[model samples]
Every structure is written in C-alpha cells, then in structure tokens.
Target chain A: MKQIFRTIAMIFVLCLAASPSFSQTGKTETYPPIDSDALEQFGGPEGVRNWVESLFYYIMLDNRINHVFREFGNIERQIYLNTQLLQLVLGGNEVEYQGASMAAAHADLGITLTQFNAVVEAAYNACERIQLTYEACNLMIAGLAPYKHAIVTR
Target chain B: MEEAKRAKFPVSKGAALVVAMLASGLSQAGWYDSGKVLATGGVSMIDGAGGGGITPWATITGYGTKEGINGDLHYTYAPLANYTLHSLGAAVGFWDRFELSYTSSALTTGSTFDTVGLVADTLGGVTGSLAGTPINTGIEPFNTTIEMESIGAKVRVFGEAIYDSDNLIPQIAIGGFYKNNKNEDLLKTLKADKAKDWEAYISATKIFFPINTLINITARYTAANQTGLVGFGGPDGSDKEIRPEISLAYLLRKDTVIGIEWAQHGDNLEGESVEIAGLDLTGLQPTLEALGLGNVSGTLTQHESDWYDVFVAFFPNKNLSITMAYAMLGNITITPDQHGFYMSLQASF
Candidate 1:
C-alpha cells in the first residue's frame, strides 16, 4: 500500500508540475471589437442621447405602474411596453417629440453613468438598423429591463 | 497457572492483530491532522479517509483562511445489521491558520451469541464442577450486549510556503489527534482495558491552476502511532506507518467540484512482548512471547493496505456546503471487507 501511495503521489506531483507550462502557453481568444465610428454616424451623440432618454422614461413609467398594480409588476411586461413605444417614436424622424421627457425622467431617477452608457448603446443599435424593428427593440429592452430592478433596489 | 499462561498469549495475539490491522488500515486510509483551522485558507471539508486536501484551487469556498476564523457543526450516521454508529463533530479556527476540533461517536453493537456462549460454559463449569453437577446440565440461557463510545480531539497548523500570480500556492501543515474509547463489557471479559490512541502527521498541498477550469492536483502524507486495546501486554504496543494521498478536482461551476483520490498505508511494526503484570495462573503469556521475536517497538513491520475514494461537493452560497463520498477498503487483514458512503452538510455563521 505504501508503494502504491508513493506512486500516486509522484503522479500527482508530476501533473502539478506540468500544468503551468500548458496554462502559460494556451492562447486566450479575444472578442470582435464593436465599431464606435460606424455607430456614431448612425445617430451621432445627440441622436443616441435622445433615444436613451426615451427608453429610461418608459422604464420608470413601467416601474411606477408595476409598483402600484401588482399584476403588472413583471419586468418583462415593462420591457414589452418600452419596445412598443420605441418603435412608434423611432419609426421615422419622431425623435424630437419624446426625447426631452425621457431624458428628464432618467436624470430624475439618478441613473448611474454605467447604466446611461448601456442605454445609449441600446438606443444607437435600435436607430441604426442594427436592431431595425420593434421586435429587435423589444429584445434589447428585455435584456436591459432586469437592470431596472437592480438600479431601483440599489 | 497453565490456564493463566494460555490465556495471556491469545489476548496478546489479539492485541497484536488489532494494532497491526489499525496501523495498516489507517496508513492506507491516509490518516492525518487537517492542519489549518476552519478559518485557514485550505480545504474546508474533511474527506472520507479522514484526511484533508480535496483539490485546492485559487477560488476560496468557505470563510476559513489565514486571515479569519470559521466554525462548523457536522454529523455522520452509518447503520449495519448488528451495529449502528453515529458521530457528531465541531471544529474551530484561530487566526485563520490553526484549527482545533472535537468529535464524539457512539457505537451500539446489538446482542451477540458469541459473548453469551462464552459466558454460559465458563460460568456453568465454575459452579457445576464445584457442586458435582455436570457443567452442560447447569447451563442456562444467557444474554449479552455491547456498546462502545469514542471521543477525539485534533489540532492542525498550516501556512503558505510559496505564492505566485497564477494562483498556485504551496502550503504545508502538521496536526495531531488523541482518541479515547470505552467499551462496556468487552473489556471486562477480555481482561483488557479501554482503548486510547494518539497520532501526529504532516502534509503539503500545492495548488496549480494550469487550466482555468481545473485544479491540477494536490498531494499529502501522514504518519501516526497505533493504540493497543489488549491491556498489560507489551508496554502498550504501538506501531508507526506512512501514508501518501493524491487527488484531482475539476470545477463544474464556480461553486461546485468533483474529484477522486487514492491513498495507501505501510506495513505494521513488530514490537517487544508485553508484561502481563498482575493476572495469575493464565496460559496466555508464553504464546505471546513466542510471537514477539519479529516485533519492533516504534516502527512499522507487518500488515498494511490501501484505499480509494470518490467525492463531490456543492457550494450553494458562501457560507454553506454539502458533500457526498464513497470509499472502498482494500487488502484488509484482521477486519472484514469494508465499504462506506457518507453525506454531510456544513454551514458557518
């Protein structure tokens, strides 16, 4: 038994000794870069900012309604509503109509800088045809919707 | 006087067998002190063979480490046809580096025909031969039951020897444990005393995260002193053994791990013949002295084995975990073939 244990120990030591070389040499794959320049031309900073403002207002409105009426409290429902609103406003050049109200509401809710950047990214994709439609907007809204609860609770 | 000498040898032989078996079994089982307290930055749970280091990785699972303290309460239960054993233990850490623990267990071996059979004839002979009634005619129904209890305390000390940026750290630890057992009627019948055993051990674990999702390997070794249950025989016969262990763990998720380990123990040592101090007229002594020729007092000599274990652990949150393990005993000499499976849940506050 002692001999067996010693052999097992030696095997483990050798494996431990060999691991570092494998780890050090293994190549780390990187992700494809996001094109910020192409993104800027689609909406410029102002257009992106306006789209973000609108999305925030929709999120806050949904949170208020869900807080008051337990049946509508689902975050997914809020995301659906935000998607529909973004579709109607961004269908053409209707950005000016909803931009100010959305921006004011988000600012009032104390949205953090990180969250604001996320909102801008989402809006830029929505307007530049990257997202291109209400269904796409809804997907983005659903993805960002969970963050609303986190922000509010924090 | 002849009977007294005869009795001495068998008792001594049995004691020798027990010592040899225990030393061999434990060494194979990789007996050791899990150096490092509950708060120390090492493995948090003890494995099936009563050893430590269940695959070390860079990510810390429990609250115990070199800088803080952690404590836990655990229970184990195993039931067989004639006996049932239960153990409850508690461990605590000091300054995240040193650990102290205590465990108490109760073993209840139900009524036995062998013990009853021995008493019936011995008692019948004592009474009938004096009264001139045949001993067999005087025999009557006899009942025998046995219960055993054991308690142990352990302490472990551990620290890091090398630390690197890749999260690989080499650490070593030393620990000691003392165990005491009480058996109600068995000791009295065998003319033996309670059992006491002490063990000290040292081990090292070096964690290498050569791969992001795997903990390459961990190894350990331990040595301990055997306990003699047969009383007044040979200076309290003790044996020493060496055991080495190795294990590998792969992370299924950040909070879950799976691993397997193998360990083996060295042979038992032959020691000097024990003195049967006060008992008189027993035929057991000479038989024992004859077998003492090859014994060594403090080192390993004969009878050893090896064991294998597979285990899994789940960490649902930062302060709680559950583990399951199975072990197979191999090359046993005096004891029956044994297999054990265990499940344990631990939480710290």
Candidate 2:
C-alpha cells in the first residue's frame, strides 16, 4: 500500500514538474490579440486565401462537415468564390457575391451546434497547421464564431 | 478476500437535494435528452463501463444529453501473443445521474501454457494418467480461456467534463466494480483468498476547450488479482492496492478523437518461489529441485506492470462509434513489451 502511494506521489510530482514548461511557451491565449485589424494582420486577400484553403482542407477531412463540402459541386470554384467573399467581408476587394444566406444554405442540412463547433475547431487546427501566429489564429476563430447562429439549424 | 470498505465522498446538501428531487419526480421519464455532444459519452472500456479503452471515466453513456435514459451495447476484440480477449457488454445511464454496466470477458491462453511448459511440467509425482505423474494442472490445450464477469456502477456527483469550459471544476464520479471469476478450482489451487473481488474508483475529467482536449484521471483501489482474470488476492496476503490511470484525448473533430491511455495493474497473486526465475515462490522449491526444475521460478504471476494504448475513436453518427488502437502491454508478467491490436464496436442511444 505504501508502495502504491509512493508510486502515485511520484507520478503527481512528474506531472506538476512538466506542466509549467508548456504554459511558458505562451500558447494559452484563447484568441489572438489584434493590433490593427484581422485582414491587415492576415496580409490581405492572398493571405486570407491560404488560410481559407487550409481551413477547407481540414473541414473536408472532418467527418461531421465533410458531407456539406462535397455536396457542393465545383469545390475549387466554390472555394475561390468563398475566399473572395471573405476578402470582401474583411475589407480586401470590392467583390460582389450573390451568396446564399448562411441560414438558407445550411437550413436543409440539419447542422447541429456540435457540428458547427467541430467546424470551428477545424478552423483552429488549420490555423496552427498553416503556422498562423497566435494573434492571427485567434482573430480567425473570433471572426468565424459569430456565424454559428447562421450555420447551425438544429 | 473482500475488497476494503468503500471509500466515501461528501455530497454537498445542495447537490444531494437536487439529485433527490430529480429522482423522486423524474422516475420512469421517457425519451431522454442527448447528453453532451457527439462521441462525448466516451468509448467503452474493457470492463464495459463508459470511458476510454481500459479506464472508466465519469462520462455517462448514450446521447441522453442529461434528461433521459441511454444504453450502449459493445463488443471488443483484442489479439495478443499469449491470449486473445473478447468482451461483450452493455451499459445504461439514467437521467445522467447513475450508470450501471456489465461485461463478460473471455481470455484465450491457447498454447500459452505450452509456451511455459506449465501443464507438461512434473506435478509432484502424483499418480496421474499421463507419464504416471499428474500434469501441471494449470490448464490443458482446449480449455485455454478463462471466463470472468464484471458488474459496475457509477454516479456522477457534479460538474461537466466535456461540455462546460467555464469553470475549472472537473466532473467527478465515484464507482465500483464487482467481479466474479468462474474458475474457482484454479483460484483455490493458486491460493487466492477469494473467487470474487471488487474495485472502487473515483474519476475526474475536465475539458480544456481552448486546447481542444479532454483529460481524465482515475484512482482505483482494488483487490482483484490480475484485474480478476486469475482471481483475487492470493496467499501473498489479501490486500488492495491503489492504481492510477489516465486518458487524454484530443478532438480532431467533434465526432472524432485521438487519444492515449495509461493504466497500471497490481500483482495480487502471491508468489510461491519468491526467488525462482523471479516468480515469488512461497514454498515449492525442494520438490522442484528434485525434478531438475530448480532454476524455474515464478510458478504464479508475481510482478505487474503498466499498460498503454494509442487509439482513435470515430463516430459516423450519434448512435454508432468505432475505436481502433494499438496497445503496449509493457512487461506484463513474463512477457516483454507485447504489442497488440484492439478494436471495438459501440452502439449507443
């Protein structure tokens, strides 16, 4: 019994010892801190293009939202159009898109809040995968989170 | 031997009042809520409880988000060098308050005894049929598998492990498993104190949404020998030991998680040749010396080690989940680091 306690105590100590190094690396921020604005920090339309491309790749691999990505035909064109729309929203180009409302586009798909969360999570992971800075990734997540009400129907 | 007295955890008056009110008012409620998110119920553990592959956490089973009753049926197949394990079990959660589970495990040690020459080794010169001496009597060819059953129950005290990221408070649960091993004759011969033993545990789980990860830790006190596969506390003295286990999973998708788990096992079986080949032998040395098997040792399982696995769980939908894992059963008994494949199919509603 004492041996077991000793072993458990040893493990506790090890866990405590290892925890601080991670916190020190300073990735603990939930969202990135913005200096000027999201698009300016993202380096304009081309930068947003790479981020959207990587984000879409992760979403396509995610089982929960992948169906929605595939069901939309001409994925490459759709991706191009969406990126353009994002640029327009983030003050990039004066592009015009007769896009479907988020509600109308997803109302038939029965997207749950959980699925929307997964999409958001994928965006976060994609930010890291694309080597976005702490502030840039956080900004993207913050920007995308507002669309949950539009994207989730169920 | 019986397990130690159950550990007690304090239930705050407010929490107790809430549980009592719900139980009294919500008995036999129909069509439960899908508790938590998808695949958040966690995959079934080896003991048939809800959690990771080998450790049971605080998560309730099913999609019953916290209001209705949910049940799960699962079957797991694991192949190892010495034995193959097949477990079939089911678990049910009521109003996300209490959980009950049961699983039957079959471990086939086929030719495992042969590998150690256990049955063929000289058996104290008893007048037996084969070779005019009793066989090792451990287990012969066809009857290689040992069958055991486990019944488990857990109660969620408070908090949310997966969904609630607002507070630092983790979800806490207290649970116990009652195990009955069927091979009483084998257990008796091995000097196990009892054919039945139990394990009691308290688990805490928390989700760090910022990191997209969930971590659970369970501290278990158990008297079962070799997790009750070989029976309970042996002649080595009937005492329980605390074992700690942890499972950490990262959500790659809301419906998919990839994780690693670590669990340690205790050697509850008493050793006979405390020194022989490291088997902790008690008193069978002289007879073995006469048989030219003096160098052989560890007649019963003596040393124990930790188990680890890297696994991925995928949920195609809310009701179905599949888990695939590669396990490292490090230095269990006489084996080196043995590696194996584990797969389980779970249906929950």
Candidate 3:
C-alpha cells in the first residue's frame, strides 16, 4: 500500500510542479472594453459617482493613507478624476478620464503596497455602505487589482 | 484639503476600531505594520507552519509586508475518538520573506494503552502456555502522554501569492522543521530508531483571483513516524520519503473562506515483527493465527493513514481569526479511524 501511494503521489506532485512554472512578465497599457454588467450593477455613472464619494469619506478617515491624500491636496479635483475613471472602468463610455495614467499619477507619490491596500479597503467599505452585492464588490476588486503594480512605487 | 479633514466620514465603529488598532500605535517603531491584506497571512498549521489546519503553504504567517515585521500566537485542540491532540505555537514573520516558528504538541494516549495492554496479555498467555515459560511483552497499560517540540523556518524563494494577480505562476517556498520527542524511554520501548529528526518541504501556493480560489501544493520529505510524536524512523520500514499535501480554498467573502486539505504520512512501522526481551516472535505467527488471534507480528505492526480536514475560517478583523475544522486523522498506532472536530484561534500583532 505504501509503495502504491508513493508512486501515485510522486506523479501528481511532478505534474503540478512542471506546469505554469514561468511567471507572467511585462505589462499592458490598454484596458479591456468596459464591463457593462458591472456598470449596471453599480447603477450607471451617477451611482458610480456616489460610490466614489463615499470611498473618499472612508479614505479621509483611514489613517494609513489619509496623510498622503492630505499632502496631495485638491480633494474635489481628486474626487472628480477618480469618479470619471471608475465610471469608464465600469463601462460608462459617455465619459473619458482626463487624468494621468496610473503609473504616472503615483510615480512620485512614494506609495507603498500597504498604502495601496488601504485604498482598496476603503473602497470595499464604501461598497458595503452603498449596499453593493458581494459579487459586485468582488468584480470591482478584480477590476482594480492589476493597478497595484503601477501604483505601489515604494 | 482642510475641508477634507473635517469631512465627517461617519464610518462604522468596527472599521474605525480595526483601523485604529492595526494601523496606528506602531508606525513610529516602523514595525508590526500589519500591512498585508486581511486573510492574506494564513493561520498557523498543526506543526506551527503558516498554512491551513494541517498543511503548510508558501505564504508567510503574519500581516507584515516586505518592509515590516509581524507575529502571532495560536492554540489548537483536536479530540479524536481514542486520543486527543493539543498544540500551542508562536510564529514571527520577518518582512514577509522569512519566518521562524516554534510549537509544542502533545498527544494523550491513555485510552490507546488499554487496547495495547489487551493485546500484550493475549500474546503473553499464548506464548507462555505453548513454550512452558512466561514471556513479558513489556507493554504497559499506564496512561502517559507523548510530547514533542519543533522549531521551523521558511524562506520564500520567488513569485507573489496575493499580488501579481494576473499570473499563473505560484509563489514557491522552502522550509524545514527539526522536531524532538520528549518521551525517550517510551520511544525505545516502541523500537523507534531515533527520538529526533528533521523534515523538509517545498511548497507552491497560488490565488486564482477570478474564481476567488486558492490552491497550494507541498512536497515534504521526512522519516518521522506520526509526525514525530511516536518518534522518528523505526525497526520496520524506516525510509525518508516525499509525501504530498494539497489544499484548495474558496473565498466565500473577503473575510471568510472554506477549504479542504489532504496530507499523506510515511508508514514507517508497517510489517514490524514483535520481539519480547530479545526473543523473536516470528516463529509463533502460525500458531497465533490458528488460534484466531491473527499473526503475532501483526500485534506490533503500525500502519499510519493520511490526514484530511475540511475547515472554515472567519477573520473578524485583521488582528484576530477563528477556524473550525473536521479533521480525519486516519490511524494512530493501533487506533483506527481517529477523526473528530478541531479548532484554532490566532491573534496577530
């Protein structure tokens, strides 16, 4: 019994180890066409605006990244640009984000991964405040997850 | 900007409390950052390794990021049908790259000794009547505990488990544990070759974000019998071999997850023949079998089974987590199908 188990286990381990051994390198500047379903879940562009506003409130309250936001200044402009970007990402083709690219925007911010995750947490709490479905929140998180590489310069 | 400072956020008290407790108070020290996302740092495994209930993964133990440190303490209790297992441990993660851990584990074998005593009495009666001489198997029925201490270390080799979400490559790590059993005399009676040994393993863990699923695979090489509680190696089949463990977890929510794991064990004492005070019992196997008592060698043979568990973990906040599981630990020495409920509580800082 031991020999048989060893043989089967060895085969299984070898297969898992051999597959997908290479890392995903490089980056893409293009975003996928807006997810209309997700936009609908967020109740279109107006709902997205409210969600971003709620997110700003949490961000200011969060001690981890609030100081960075305070240092950046221009709270109103930050909210406008973020709302537009979120709308476009959630499939609102009616508006275009006239802001800097994610990497360029945060390049000089010295933002650490910890601070980046803090922003994500703030966004999650905002979703809960707005009563977004669990699936909707996950979709939003998955949509925003890839931006971590560009934003976390530190 | 000044207006934003007085924005009246109206956030939940729970959120405020978690943020105040986890993010504040330690920034000046530049340590205990608790920077990792919630649930990213897994709970401590049975052997104090950072992973699930029984299997270790590639992820580090605490919420520390690459620039900071974090640590936690855990206690686990598992009561099987014939025995109970208890473990308490502490682990510290250094910059989320390296980990050091220590665990003390105990197994209560009081009930198991009753069955062992029965076997010894039956074997002694048969041998004494057949050979016209009394033989002592040296099996005592007294209740005693098997205790062990382990020190473990792990280093993440490459890849990222939580970040780099757009990848198929998993985070890989290498680790080892040095375990020493406290019961030296009991192990010698059980014919264990050694009381202490080291085990090594390589683990690969990946999180598939789209599915909210995590898969971790580990291959461990060791000769420790029953995870070194009963001792290392043995007089029977003592060979250090690679055993595979796998875990699959699905994130039910951001702070909740359910998972299952399977870990194989080395059967180091299978087919061992009994010896009573330097007297070989192989010659009595046929007679014992004819008497409907089975082979005499079988009395001493130990067959171990793989371990499996289905567990659910809830992260109430970053600082605390509670995990409950149904653990199926197949056989411990002569006991069969030793399975029961297991639970663990961990507090991180």
Quote model 3's TM-score: 0.80
User: Scoring only the second chain, what is candidate 2's TM-score?
Assistant: 0.81
Candidate achieving the largest lDDT: 3
Per-candidate count of clashing residue pairs (backbone under 3 Å): 33, 20, 0
For model 3, how does the per-residue alpha-carbon lDDT over B1-349 read when each residue is reduced to its tens digit?
5223322322233234333443452554766678888899999898887998888899988888887878778889998897788998777787889987778898877666554456556766776677777544334467668888777789987777765554455788889887778777556656677877778898989876546778999999889878888788888545789999999998888899999999998767655544453443465567557766564456555668888999999999988989999999887776688899999989888
Cα error of candidate 2 at position A1, Å: 20
TM-score, every prediction: 0.44, 0.64, 0.80
**A-chain TM-score, model 3:** 0.76
Question: What's the distance in Å from true for residue A55, model 1?
Answer: 24
User: Which CAPRI quality tier does the interface of model 2 achieve?
Assistant: incorrect
DockQ of predictions, in order shown: 0.03, 0.06, 0.20
Query: Model 1 segments beyond 4 Å from truth?
Result: A1-154, B1-62, B80-83, B110-169, B184-194, B211-236, B263-305, B330-335
Query: TM-score: which candidate is best?
Result: 3
List the candidate 3 regions with Cα displacement exceeding 4 Å: A1-36, A87-95, B1-28, B118-140, B188-191, B271-301
Model 3 residue B123 lDDT? 63
Best by DockQ: 3
Per-residue lDDT tens digits for candidate 2, residues B89-182, read 7777776778877788998766655424452344433324434544343455564667887878899877656433323456878798877777
